[model samples]
Target: MADAVFDEETNVLLSQVDIEPVDANWFDIETDFVLSQFNLDNVLDMDVKSGNFPYSQTIGDLNVEANKTETGNCSSKRFNFEAKSSDVKKLQASSTPLNTQKNTRWDVNTWDDWGKWRNDRTISAGLKESAPYVLVPPLTVDIGAAELCHWMCRFILEVRRQDGSEYPAESLRQLCISIWRYLRDTCRRYDLNFFDRSKPDFADLRECLDARMKELNVSINKVKKQAKPINRTEEDILWSSVFSLNDAACLQYAVYLYACKLFGLRAADEHADLSVTQFTFGRDDVGQFIRYIGGRSKTVQGGIFHKKVLAKDIKQYANDSNPRCVVNLFQKYLSLVPEDGPFYRRPLATKTADGDQNTQHRRLVSIPYRSSCRECAKGQVLTASRLDTLVK
Candidate 1:
């Protein structure tokens, strides 16, 4: 009525606001979409801007090329700790001196645009080699392949993020050996068969790793004359552990510990990681966790698989939480994990175990946390659900 008294045309325009648009975050992202899991009212401080993201197939037949689509959209999110975001942006702005951190320029955008820039640097270095090495002059392409090992080493054993808090630093020597094994297996496609002496890329590191592997095997033989070999299937036998999932609460932890003992999982105690999909309920509603594959799964045939789990025929299993200890663990620990974070993950103890003294120390001291995540999204996706007009 007041708007009509001042300006009738403006009032009509205001009244005709689209319901979806009015409820959304000023972007096309729907409130119903967010509200399906989180209360839209709980979120605060939103800033809208243009950003870029890519959508592509997770894995495809090598003969088939993945279709690529690049889109501009909202990129980052900040909930609490406004100061942390400020600090990062400030550091980004303060990058002044080019070639400051070694010949590497800070102007490298995307945080991953080091390809051409690094190639340019390599040639620049190769051109500066001294006289005696002229006959064996390094190729224009040089970024000490040893540094590649170090880059991977950091990934293998660096301090892992524990949901952005509480970290324990540890060396990744055994972890590197595991990674070396995986790389030696994976690099085969790129003509980098590290295990084969004939492959060109099979060089010093692979040879050393091979020798080290033999040495470790010999050492392990000397030490473990009586250790039982429990393969993955044997370990994941949860009816053997504190079994079943009758209670929504208790089944949660049993599922977690089963992952831990069976799959060498570490982060299942986190509730947010549990998704509607992970809860594979049978016709009888008997639910059980199946398997989680990594995004960079060589098994999945691509760089990343967006969906982590495969619904299997394992639901004929069990759901009566008899032992009750697992229920205690779930209530005391797993229940506290955010309802929207990654699902179960392998523990540091499992991933990095090899009789390393330091690893043992950390296992005794550090809390378990997952650096990896399985995205939690429901198959029953929410769309343009909106509030009724005039509360009718």
Candidate 2:
């Protein structure tokens, strides 16, 4: 049911065939079913398809290439979420843009790269020159490029493996990397990329993303689709009125509200999309349900993090009697959570741009869905709820 489609209107990837909405988290069918139909299992652990890169070259003793002719999906200017790419014709990872002080995602591929271009030895000159006040003491929120670079480098290498396996060590790094990647993009739009770009080679990788962007730009659906996400304009919890009706839709919204207000978590990767394990209780601190925590984050780049789902609302919605298939990976066993898993998830956001609607559009509705799913509060629908409504 899921075939490749070329949509001339949006220049976004589409399917020759229509795919039914099995769920927001994953494909409706099992991976085995898909693999059987496409014979993909036979291709694993093998060489990838061949291709020609027109922009191949050498830079600073490293072989380089661009994704010049590769096809783009949701990363075009339309959405702006970036993917860790292996394409060559896109852009030079080291090609620092004019007027921009930091490097692109493609430029740095090793710890040595961090030492030189990223100013790993100390704080970034860029931060000191611009906002000196922000750098005077123990940097709290606004950070410099150097420290961020070092942190990101360390985190990435912690989980990065030559074997290309998503083992325990690697998964943690990926989760952190994924979280930081979305945060980086958010900061960029909010004028914070200088301190927020912690994604693996975001600066360098982004440099080589231009071609892919262009290609993807030519494949999306022009104009927002009707089914796009419907994000709100303010942090409105007015939906609490559903106290008496704890039905599926109401409970879903309540859980969404808790995610936005409580954890401020918003991610679209596998960890968030799937339902978390749950258990029932009585008059307990966790109330009725408890979410499964200790899962990995998608942007971990590297490093292990064990997060506890220490929230009240989340406990009520754990996968149990009223389970809505919501995933709660951070419940317990933080040590078991992978680094490359989704930190928070829901439906994909409506658009990549700063829009009120976060989940109205369906298919690749802007890269926000790829990055941060629509937040259920604080720019989500506003509603009032009786505390008992969430009790069960």
Candidate 3:
């Protein structure tokens, strides 16, 4: 009965209410017998008299608006992985409002604001007072279509930044496509038909843009390189230096870094609550292990569950405090953290008002110490952007 209601294996449940049982004649009970069990008079009862439903409860428009305001609140609490947004806000298409809202899930006002940002462009002077880069000295709406198209082509192919750096071929191709889209949108807005392929001017302009994009694609394909995975030697070198760092600042983050690598965990938006509450210690076929449960990482979204596990090893890396040992490092971190708090806290450091030139020399000679747990924010956790700096 529970499996029929909700299936864990399939991650699905019945959505519609079972108003009437389909297979009513079962266990010696006839369909008519089952129908007779119902109190037909209840249809006239006061409870049934109201034209309301059990499944849906009506709410005020104000409440609906208030709920909508909290829709994007998750973005604020997201981990700054790569310092970029990773939240998946899917676009939806709808009709009945006349099918005008195709892939219009995004707010129109927000889209307009972003479009303004995309349209804005500026060129800055570089070092040594170099000439500022410009695209055809800027054009106005009064400019002839032919002249505008000519300059647009010139901008796409020849223009460079103040630093004497031309746009990448792939990027320039995208820019060309965007310009074409802008032209179409503008024409549509003003009830013009300049983009009609049947028109001679439109066909010529389209051919020109298409040829330019093909040229860019050729260049892009020529320079394309395949990304390769990191080798064991490279990993060893990176981790060795990280674990052996003498500075307290380096050691402070080394523990978390080691743990991440061992458990195949991304140092970002994976764990919703990376506190002790999610941790579990148990034994498997490989012996004692630590498990992290219920973290909706990007690697496993949807209804899928992800659990990170660290198995106990027979051989320890070092007799003393070794930052490379995941088990030891995790235990140390756990001891410092409270029963329920952030697994990784911010590193601590004191600053001098008047810095000395011997700062580097002093750091080199300084003995590493444990990061002070007392200095950490009560409920705050380390972020991926900070992890990137530490890795660097």
Candidate 4:
């Protein structure tokens, strides 16, 4: 009513107040047709003026603006605008963040864009690298159920690790299950019919896959039983020479071994999660107890693991000629480490002369706190490869 009153007083139409003059040459009819397909009628409200059309839409303060440029043909002008509509919002909501840390869905977008070719290319690439292709391709929608069963069997035989060992049967079964889940989820997103429960098409494929998985589970259990823990003799040898070692790498590794045993941390978990700030000391009746919160890993049941050790337990391992004392070693390691940083660090080169024992001892004992240890502090945590080498 107010707009009509004002327009009548000014002798102008209310609709003409904010509307832009349209020129048909400035409008792209094909683009308008595409927008109309999604029922977004109000998105680009173009009006015809002098056989020309200019797009305009206004809702409250929101308005669509288009930049027009005349084509060489002169009969048409290209219209470009920032597209923001309800369909775009729906798409943004559907796209979830992938689990890149685990590398499980690292190639999800690439695989989706390339469709079945991504799976085939992955298999070919894995074959060339001699690594097990854990990503099992789902039975193509166009293939028969019998063909899927045949493909599954062939896939199982073809998959092998970089070390030339076949994937454990349990892992193969898991891969199949994971692939099926991925296919079903993706199909649901696109509103496609993936499988019919009432039909017998998938029955044979399911039966054969389950049977293979059962056989593989039994073999997996046997392999798990045969697996052994780290040798105790090797642990002793590692700690025994740690005191005589002045090398930064050796010291860093010694700290790692003791920390692993003290906290029962997995190699990957400790390397990634263990930092200088994770340690704290408390007093008890026995003596001081050192506690640490270990980082999370795949095998770790809880997201975080808390472990504590009595200072005396590590003190027993200490000797005049040996730095096997976990507490002392941790303290020395802490002196060189940054607060809230990685507890284990890669070493820098030694500045002391190779033949100068006194100088090396002085350098080790006189390491300045809060000052950068020259050629001996790389600030990196111990890695799996480094851990393996330290063990050997």
Candidate 5:
């Protein structure tokens, strides 16, 4: 009887199940079951609560309140954007204005200082009253090429040495060249149209300068006497004489002579400006020597024109066995002098007076050799004049 009841129930379930064939576009069709599962009202209510749907009216009065709040937020954002843009415009208006007057010439004060120095040089050279060709600021004065040529001729003819003697041909030529350089540089800086080589006046000026230089050279050569150079025998005699003397003054003179011979130092300010620090003791494969560190020289003045130029290396070798060894003399001199003072100093001495029956005799009193601190304090050194007279 249970089997009969199970079969009847299975048959009844099968008869109630509807087995229909699905269409080709079955996913596109929305059946009643899918439509009933998704509620549009609930989705609209959720969107309104989350403020995603601005036109949602399912919550009637709340919709109007939400719209008003959203409108105020948008208005506030627009106002902030407008305010930022206006502030940017105001900043641009108040910023520093562009400099309309473009300055081509650099450093006005430097040019003015140069003008003053040129004036002083002219006065010292005794050409101020005669030539009277003052260099003013560029573009302010109109100096023609002819005028420049005339001024330079006058300068060359009238310039004299401190002893009131005429300048040598070389010196006059150099002065004229320097003056032309100054004028050319000044014209370039101020963008003036002067010293044009293409023009006839400039050509004529150069021709005149060349002709005058040739004539001056010829005249100077006729009168100027050539100086004789000291021979090796004379140099040996000088060295022996300097070495024989045991006085402090003679020792200093020996050191000066050695420095001039070994280092090729000029008879001018090179010896005057020397300090103790420039020399260094070093040794190489050859032998031991004292190295001299070269600095600003006559040809190289450490200016912009001499950039990246290496200074010359001057060295004096040691001759320990020799009586007039430069190294030994220098070391002995160093031992006698102070560390901080100049390389050259004045040797000190004392004087004594002896009274006899008829006359009183004053003589130099002998004392230990010492350099004078008072003379060094007075800025005195071995001048070129004294150096010239040492051997004589």
Candidate 6:
């Protein structure tokens, strides 16, 4: 009876299973179809017609033509294709990779600009054409330790803004570092011996930079007048004043100031980059809040090296009781602006009721703002300079 029951279960399971037989020639047919898509004859013909297959022959022909050219006679030795090819391959291997070349170009341009500035300054100072302090292209000149030190000292002491004000201590430090980096990179690229940290010159350079920086700081501090920090009471007064005003310009200013404080934004540029999409309304277990998703900033630049340093997501809870609540102000501001685009935009202008042709009033009007440039209508974002002016 047990054996009969087991057999009945096995038969039922087998009856439930359905298997379809595949054609034996299906694999062959599929393989043939894929192979047929690539015409070997056409590929070979194209390569031959394009003069690509016989790479060695093509290179030899080019070399022969080059040897017959007038510029080819400038070199003492005849053009050796094999040797030249090997050298080029080695250079390509040793040089900066294609992926990183974009960043290197910016550095190169900066270095060249610095060199030009140095030249201009030397000329203005009525120095001789052979002035040791004047900077030249790192790749073209071989800088010695003493020469470099002299140049750094002169640069720190002489370089000034258009208004003749001295550069800030931090700015001077960064400039020195950037120039050093350019020199170091040039040395590595051409296999030169200058600017190596292991050398005594490097040690002297470091000590000089440290000493100059300290001196600069002391001198700058003697004359530096810093702005007073806004106290909480002062802030309250300012906030109340801005909030009380029902004007469009005042509302925008309030929102900008509130956003800056809430988001812990320090630089004017950061505020300029803010947009509507960066903020979102969400509900948590406690209550409703406005969440801000941060991106690239002064401290946190998202890259492979900064993978561990995650972008910060900040939340500001809603305060219904407070008349000057950030959440309420933000919501009201959003309602006045478009659903998308920059957080801050140009204030709308409307004609006054008096019908004076020259009189116009600025107010919050909900409409898409267009850029002045006809070719591109997208760059309507508030600029850092304008933000600075507003803050002042």
Which has the higher TM-score value, candidate number 1 or candidate number 5? 5
Query: Which candidate has the highest lDDT of all?
Result: 6
Cα lDDT computed for each candidate against the true fold:
0.33, 0.35, 0.43, 0.47, 0.54, 0.58
- Order the candidates by lDDT, highest first: 6, 5, 4, 3, 2, 1
Q: Return the TM-score for each candidate structure.
A: 0.26, 0.22, 0.35, 0.43, 0.47, 0.51
Off by over 4 Å in 5: 1-142, 150-171, 181-200, 217-227, 243-245, 350-392
lDDT of 5 at 285: 92
How accurate locally is residue 55 in candidate 6, as Cα lDDT from 0 to 100? 53
What TM-score, to 2 decimals, does candidate 5 have?
A: 0.47
- In candidate 6, how many Å is residue 371 off? 21
Model 4, 1-392: lDDT tens per residue?
55665664577656656656789978677665554367433433433333333423243223322222234324344444456797786664334322322333423332243345546776777654454443444434543444555555555445554476656666666555544544455433222222345546555555665676676666654445321234555455445644334556565666655555555554453455455666776666666556675444444333223233221122222234544556666666565545555454545554434431121212232212113312222332333333343332
Give RMSD to native, each candidate: 25.1, 29.0, 18.3, 18.8, 23.1, 16.9
Better of 2 and 5 by lDDT: 5
lDDT of 1 by residue, 43-116 (tens): 32121112221323222332244222111122233233446787986665444222232222221121123333
Local lDDT at 203 for model 2:
67
Q: In terms of lDDT, which candidate is stronger, 4 or 6?
A: 6
lDDT of 6: 0.58
Model 3, which residues run further than 4 Å from truth? 1-164, 173-214, 217-251, 265-279, 293-325, 348-392
**lDDT (Cα, tens digit) per residue for candidate 5, span 1-392:** 34654675465555555557777786755655566677788888889889998864676577778989989989887555555787876764433222211121222333344456566776677664454355533323466655655544444455565477665666655555444444444444332222456666556556666677687777775464432343455556545544333455666666765676566665444655566677778899989888888766655456666777877688888987877677777776665555543566655443223211111122113211113211321232433332333332
Model 2, CA-based lDDT: 0.35
- What is the Å distance of residue 289 in model 2 from its true position? 5.5
